[model samples]
Target: MKAPRAVIFVSLFLLTFQSKAQTKFDHSIWDQILLLNVTKDGKVNYGGFMKDSSQLYEYFTLLSQNPPTEQWSKEEKLAYWINAYNAYTIKLVIDSYPISSIKDIKDPWNKKFFKINGEWYSLNDLEHKILRKMNDPRIHFAINCASFSCPVVWNRAYTGANVESALENQTKKFINDPLRNTITEDVVSVSKIFSWYKKDFKIDGKNVVDFINKYATTKIINQSKKGYKTYDWSLNE
Candidate 1:
């Protein structure tokens, strides 16, 4: 009897743990994001984006409608908040209709732009505190700030499965483009991103050039050019 009872207890514990693990995330909407329009200029045209503001209002409703006492895994939390930030930022831009920059949609001092996970939050807080703090640097390029200086929006949506690879490609492509980097045998100059986020690229005793070199085109690596150009941030309109 004791042996049979022990087996039952073990079985029950394993089932409970599996349920907890699988329940950490709800990924049903991942496909919807991937389906949204992403353009080569890295613009999220979000055709009818203004009309889509209603969608965001509904999504935010889901997050705040429930208060979860159940602890979510870090990956689950990061993915949810990042998506929320991007969605809300885009909504903010479209809501104003003729906005020139994302800055135009936000408060100067950085206050609540929307409610998320039951808390009022700002784009600045979400990017700096949640994403960067989580060590996911690729997000810098993936989230569009409605500026031409920002990374080109890719053609696909960000899904949980491809999130890491998508971010890597964005960083590499943005850093290596001639518009973003200047390469020479003796010296190299690149976007302020190279300087500002050096830690992200310094994975193995490498600086920005070393990082860009991995994806730099032949012309870029030869350093046969005079100089690199700055990206015009005048809204991608």
Candidate 2:
């Protein structure tokens, strides 16, 4: 009788632990990895991430095992997808380490290499099919493409509670970042992302200039000459 009682106790403990683990997706591992490898200015240390690749693998395992479910809140789901996109992009670069540019890999964004809940996906799926469909233009700044011209990868993980603010902060940071966008009272020279996804910024009858002014430190005149800077494809390491 005592043996049976001990077995029941052990089983219950394991069940409880599993339940708690599945309740909320844990991003602490990824968060720690970012903190250790990424700079505040958004420069990544691929060598550092390579050395700590085991932790990245562990984080991916957790994400694959617990893909978002219907029970998750909208914010929770969005945050998960955003983090997954950025993290996997990092993994891609590290896997192809020593490459001068992500562009070196043919069809890099379209190559399906990661898995979630037993389903395969590529960066294009995450950026276009899922995230872009979500209808938040600020997402462009939150997801990094491992290029010098792309938005800096945040050094922190996005949690459901922080996703909204993070989006806002990232948009403002990227827009005002002189290196990324040159916004002035007379002219607006910005990233090619603005041209690529121009429709996304023109939400609610507003134009791209209006959207830039929303976060830009210096507002561009409506008639100001808008030009796109030449995109640098060098790896952001």
Best by the lDDT measure: 2
Off by over 4 Å in 1: 1-36, 63-78, 106-109, 182-189, 218-231
Model 2 agreement with the true structure over 158-210: per-residue lDDT tens digits: 99889999999999999999888887766678999999999998889998888
* Candidate 1: C-alpha RMSD after superposition: 4.7
Best by TM-score: 2
**Candidate 2, residue 143: lDDT:** 97
Number of clashes in every candidate structure?
A: 3, 0
Per-residue lDDT tens digits for candidate 1, residues 1-237, read 256988989999999997676534453443354346455655566445555555556666765553233465554565566566666666666667675665675472276767755678777787777677776656677765666776775555454456677777887787756565656566466666655676876766765456666766643454433343565655554
TM-score of each candidate? 0.71, 0.89
Query: In model 2, what is the error at residue 71, expressed in angstroms?
Result: 1.6
Question: lDDT for model 2, on a 0 to 1 scale?
Answer: 0.90
lDDT of each: 0.61, 0.90
**Could you tell me which residue pairs clash in candidate 1?**
34-157, 42-152, 42-153
